[model samples]
Target: MFKNRYLYIFLHIIMWLGYTALPVLNAIQRDTSKPQTNPYTNPYYWAYVSFSSILLFYLHSEYLFPKVYKQKPIRYFILLILVIAILLVGRYSARINFVGNDINQTLFYINSFIQYLYIFGISASYSFFTDYQKQQSTKRDNEHERLKSELSFLRSQISPHFMFNLLNSLVALNRKKSNLVEPVLLKMSDLLRYMLYEKDDKQISLDNEVKYLQNYIDLQKLRFGDYVDIDFNVKVPTFSKNIEPMLLIPFVENAFKHGVGMIEKPIIRVELQTIENQLLFIVTNKFSNDVQEIKDGASGIGLTNVKRRLELLYPEQHSLKVQQKDNFYTTELKLNLRQVA
Candidate 1:
């Protein structure tokens, strides 16, 4: 695309130069005494001269014509008188004389008139183009705002669904008189508070997000215990940037819910790191290969919601990949932090 612009400019410049020099070259090369086929000595010079004159006329029409129109016929006559004065000036100018004896003056009037005409035409065209561009930009901005609003709504729905499920689990454990249930509930409450309050903003500190994830993982460990081997490694940085709320939790929840909960000897691994203006998250889980036993063809609402949020919030600034083989399910999300900042 860039190459095309440069190529256009180069061709335009060459054409203009050729037009200006052609008349002079031809006049000097051929008989000056005999009548020339083309009277203008320099077509390129006339082109530029015409272009400039027309541009000026367009500006004058925009700014000056309004005042002139207030007086009706008097203003109209003045405009005609101005044209005659311009013609007389052209008839005497030596610059025009060099280009074509007396005919040079006539050519000057014709060229100047054409230039003014073009100036009006181009000015109208430019005004229309600018208005069109602004309208297009506004439409795009409206679409983006709508997408963000939808993402926020989805995130709001996901948080409640997660809380409802966790509470249900805690209720079951409580009825059984399980000793571990109380502490997990307390931790869940704290995490829920964070999500409900702190995450309402467009961004949250990375440190806070990681802390919540860790707490959530610990709660899961209390429930799953040794039946699941969960490995989580997130090296916290001294300073933190911000990220969208509840964006990564769905993947973690899905991992435990579908992968570990269904398999006898399940393993879930997660790794996260941030460097400069980039954040990377990787999660992999081992699941049973038995297709028939894989309950209801897991269409994860959380996963779908997170993917849509990522696309709306980040667009070209983020990359998300999901892979599922016979026994392993993997998801990697990379986001550009610079945009949020």
Candidate 2:
């Protein structure tokens, strides 16, 4: 899982503050020595130790680990040892200058070596953890981009195929010299404009998407006229929400493609309802059992593409159910719009 960077920073700040203040708090509680004799009482010694620890931690985390450790592990270990030795020498010199010659030199050196090891270990662990997190984040971003590009290609395929079908409908109308042809052409123009311009957006207003769907239904109404029974109802209280562009059209297109021709009393039903952040969509169409079995690569490509898109884009945020009972094919989709993005 991903962690909030601000929260990580806040917790690290609290830890560092505690680490810096604990020694001073202990010295104050004991109150056993004059400022001139006690090393803990000397502000300069505290400043040097605190600043040196912080500087070494960042140096390893930001520079040494990234630039050296991954490429040259043995060299990095040698450099680490050198850094610890130098820090120990500086610490011993500070102790001699500030704490006087009465202190046990051997015991001080041992304690300082242990302290340096502790500091180095903490810095190394933290650096490795942060680098691992960065690598994971980069991998996720690259995968998202790949899925997005694939979805765009799938949508492009749908547009040309849909346009070909629409043009066929227009040709049929031209032969009959129907009065509805002009209106159908007008609606088709609007639909094409939306597909060309708005479809490229990552998302568009739900209201606009509904409008495009209505235009598509209207165009089909002109094509079939009174021969087919179609019911399209939309009950949306708000228009502020957004959805993936061209996401819903394929289902509706699939319904009209296979549901109407060579069937008695052809029927297609579509309903859309939105309550707060949840959206429910249903589409049901009648199909003739006598018709040839629809191949996956034939009229079912749109449905296949849509299923993959939903898995890539929404994942756990949406549910889709497709069922076939009797001579009717039904699809129901429930989407949690609030989970988008």
Candidate 3:
């Protein structure tokens, strides 16, 4: 409520000034044939009224309005009428008894009621507006926190899925006693370090993301060696840009996960190109009809996670297309880099 302290203070000053000046101005405008008995001349009367008004304003605003009215409106209205009546009676009785003034009882009651009404209206309106704004702010904060948690869970899914596949490759190399095991472990170490440390950031240098993808591709190359045909190409201009970490790797991993083993003469093609403030990523692979679709467990979870992340993070800034025709599965992603965070 006090986010803009100066504005809050300014508005409060203006309200109080108006509250103090209006009744005095009205008294000056009225016919005062008996100048000696003019109520405006009595500073004590004005002080009592001002103090009582401020007290009632805060009572209704800070306590009664929200806790009582919002929960039980009928009860609140009943209590408000009772409070107003008591205050009016008290003020009229005090004025007649203590002041020793011949003031009209009915007129005093009417004027007192009107003044308290004005105070109640002003305080209630201000309280309601500020409360509504606070509720909206709280709602936005909760949504932001939920998004962060969901993104964390999705990224968590990707790391373990990638690691499980790499570990499987390592096991295969160990059984075959392949000489490329050392290099594969080195590449895996770099990939793991990058994922563990750098992936926590909302954005990473486009250069680093490309290098991570290259490391994964090289590891896959060692795993397959001469058995499968692979074509990986990246063409990025000498420019500086940031991309969501691990955003593009799912498509490449999906290609390798479902595009080999069961298939004869398997082929995987991954290409990335950047033109100005736009990026294009395409991954295509050949699959065997005998193999199940990549919609089970780890494969399905990875794809779903990335798709949701893209929707949340990029929304209108990116487009994705996945198509399977005959034995080939292809995924094409286009992203607008201008809105990168």
**Residue pairs whose backbone atoms clash in candidate 3:** none
Candidate 3, residues 23-124, lDDT tens digits: the string is 766776675665336565456666667767887888888878988999999998998888888778767766765465687778888888988999999988
Ten contiguous residues minimizing lDDT sum, candidate 1: 290-299
Off by over 4 Å in 1: 1-116, 175-177, 291-299, 339-341
- Please state the error at residue 279 of candidate 1 in Å: 2.3
Stretches of model 2 off by over 4 angstroms after superposition: 1-17, 33-36, 176-179, 293-298, 338-341
Question: 81, model 1: CA deviation in Å?
Answer: 18
TM-score, per-candidate, Cα-based:
0.63, 0.87, 0.80
Q: List the residue pairs that clash in candidate 2.
A: none
- Candidates arranged by lDDT, highest first: 2, 3, 1
**Cα distance off (Å), candidate 1, residue 238:** 4.0
Tens digit per residue, CA lDDT, model 2, 1-341: 14677887889789888987787778876775543455766777777777777777888888789889999989988988887778878877877776667778789889878877788799889998989999999999998789878987887787877787789789987776588889999999999999888987478889988999999999888888889999999999887788888788889988988898789999999999998888899999999989875454456777788888888778898999999999999999998774334
The parts of candidate 3 lying over 4 Å away from their true place are: 1-3, 23-47, 68-83, 89-103, 175-177, 275-278, 288-296, 336-341
In angstroms, the error of model 2 at 125 is: 2.0
lDDT value for candidate 2?
Answer: 0.84
**lDDT of candidate model 1 versus the reference:** 0.71
